[model samples]
Target: MNAWICNSSDGSLISFYLMGMPFLPKSLFLPVFFIFLILYLFVITGNSLILVAVVIDSNLLKPMYFFLTNLLVLDILFTTTTIPRMLSYFLLGDQILSFPACFLQMYLFHGLSCGEAFILVVMAYDRYEAICHPLHYTVRMTPQVNIKLAAGAWLAALLIPIPAVVQSSQMAFGTMTQVVNFFCDHLAVVQASCSDSTFQTFLGFCCAMTVSFLPLLLVVLSYAHILVSILKINSKEGRSKAFSICTSHLLVVGTYYTSIIVAYVAYRADLPVDFHIMGNVVFAILTPVANPLIYTLRNKDVKAVISKFMSHWSRGYP
Candidate 1:
């Protein structure tokens, strides 16, 4: 019932059928739907609480929390872009996406994923500045500079995927091409194309590598300086305070890269298609879920603010 096309633009059937997590059996869809629905709720609720706390509490109005606000926004958008659609597919069999819609999802997924990495790097740089150059930190990390840094990270990330998405859009596709992943992931879409995918594949790898390791490299360098500065501090308490400042960010960075590496290995290994799909799914959900947890549990200031807010709300204070 689906039409095939020699060219992407000429197709009468301009839709994609998403096979949301092909690993699971149909009978299990209900349970899986419930599970992911809970996660989606957690992602929203946890990140929203932190965002609200940062906004309302004058204590959190700093360069660090400002960057955290950007990361929280990205986490919310990133999961929203994929999880709700995934939930629909699980619960209602709403798997089919129109051509434009599919590409848009793919673009947003990759762009926001890249944005998170850049923001983490920015956060690391903020830590480096605060620790390594405490006296000059206020002057260097002014509001204008922080704004520019956040804007640049987001702009560069959002722009980087344009060429790849545009090229992928031009590739040949069959009628109702079946995307093997839950969402319109870049690699999954490319593999579904009828056109030769070698160039696209390579381009994707190059972009992924650059996005993954380059920011990672920057984060490492920043921490290297942070470590040296921490050691140079004379008092034990001072050293401990400096190290504690970075622990939350470090945990987040570790979790983000670990998920990516797992996903990359799963994709590259001689594994089943389901493994690849699940890998990407984990990559999609894991970081966002872990980010809010890491910040709240590990960062004292954020935790304190969130606790105070909760108590105030429980008291029914306006």
Candidate 2:
């Protein structure tokens, strides 16, 4: 009886229950748990490596790398907020959450998530400056400016979710205790509340559109200019070199935006529970997994830094 209301019989509005991926078959538990355990390790290791590489490698300390480091930190935090609890659900069947903790989790997860969206835009702006306004790139995107931008992204994202959290905190809980998705995700919590969620839904919709989708649109607009600038390069090699830098970021942005959109749709629409659960998993789990790999594979500098670190480690061990 994971349901937590003052009176479950009438199901008024006191508490709620969590139905974390309820449709997941028992037969898939061990496999899914094992997979997520490995996935979590990969996320931590991968994102940590990106952060460390940017920190230790002086040559990698461009304005873009500054943003990359921030992105890595957000990725680490974003995955950390959800993945372990998901793992616990698979291994130990612990989906129960107190009202406070549940809402808190929702806040943190969406806050970090929204932070990542803005960081991606900042990263796009970094490239835009380097590509379009090469002469002023340094003057414009100085270390101090980069710090301010990163701080702004975090502050803006964290604050945007506050209204949702505050409203939900005051709302009465109805009979709908079971959250459809795993972990206490933002929309999941709001949808499960027995009380009317119109205000919060509108708030979240506006936030997603303005905070998330707007940044994505800016990224696309920036890259459109970048592509035009790259095409103007007379030498094919120069154009190729310039375009190569954006591929990883574009790929990451594509994956993240697509995952979130699909996931959100699944959650909102009358879709199957499996699609909803897997949709959450896609953006939450796979994006972190793909991020470091995309950067390391597509960018020579990251690969070089990784190789250097690995070589040093091997030498010490040898």
Candidate 3:
């Protein structure tokens, strides 16, 4: 019993040390680090401004904008959780994270990601109501209903990853391995486990399928129906306006889902590390940065609000 206890304690210490070590190549570090730093700054500033504008502009206070605000908030949380720490590893060379810290990062990262997926679904449904059931838009998408939907999305995201986290924490780490990726990704971390991970793999697969693929299918279906509805409208002006509203959403959703699917496929197929990294960079860095820009540039309401805000600031004494 005493020998067993000592071995267990030694194993814990080794796991702690492995979790804390930094792993990155010097040649590839600086460029990737700087690029992501710029992206992180842009994502935070852009999303924050969008959230503020949504709150201040009463005209923007509808179901669509409300859901958008939630999405902006989630994007901010998601990028901040992963990118800053990753940048620190490059800038300061402080690659070590405690087990708890790594787990925390993974939790927040996946939680918000999953939440954003559901939020996108909610947004699609909002658009559906507005386009298909125009008369019931107001009645169907009440403030209470919107709040519940947002809350449910968040709750589902948080709950879905609990099993994975628990299983991951319990896995034994036999001395020498380190996480190759910049962040503690679910699959990467699970692959390093010394215990039997069959159940963990299955659980993660289930979560990924439900959280990622199902929502993607819904998004595709929603856009398909939206397109059909737009085509039926007789007025050229009406069709043009409706298409414009959806264009931003389509671009953002397309970038997000495509990158995610590519990353998962590459990881599953054991592709080269560079390919996997590129996939993650697209999903993690580019998508969040692009989301605000896509909406602001393509959606007139956001552009108008931003222009008005900028004009107000420009004319001020500061």
Residue 46 of model 1 has an lDDT of 96
- Model 1 Cα lDDT, one tens digit per residue, 59-138: 99999999999999999999999999989998899988998888899999999999999999999999999999999999
Pick by TM-score: 1 or 3, better one:
1
Q: Write the per-residue lDDT of candidate 2 for residues 194-271, one digit (tens) a residue.
A: 566777778777777787789889999999999999989999999988898888889989878888888778778898
Error of model 2, residue 214, in angstroms:
0.3
**Looking at candidate 1, what is the lDDT of residue 76?**
95
The model with the greater TM-score, 2 or 3, is 2
Models ranked on lDDT: 1, 2, 3
lDDT tens per residue, model 3, 99-123: 7776777788788889989998988
The global Cα lDDT (0 to 1) of model 2 is 0.82
Per-residue lDDT of 12 in model 2 = 30
Query: What lDDT does the true structure give each of the candidates?
Result: 0.92, 0.82, 0.77
TM-score of each: 0.97, 0.92, 0.90
Task: Please report the candidate that would top lDDT against the real structure.
Answer: 1
Residue pairs clashing in model 2 are 13-173, 174-194
How does candidate 3 score on lDDT?
0.77
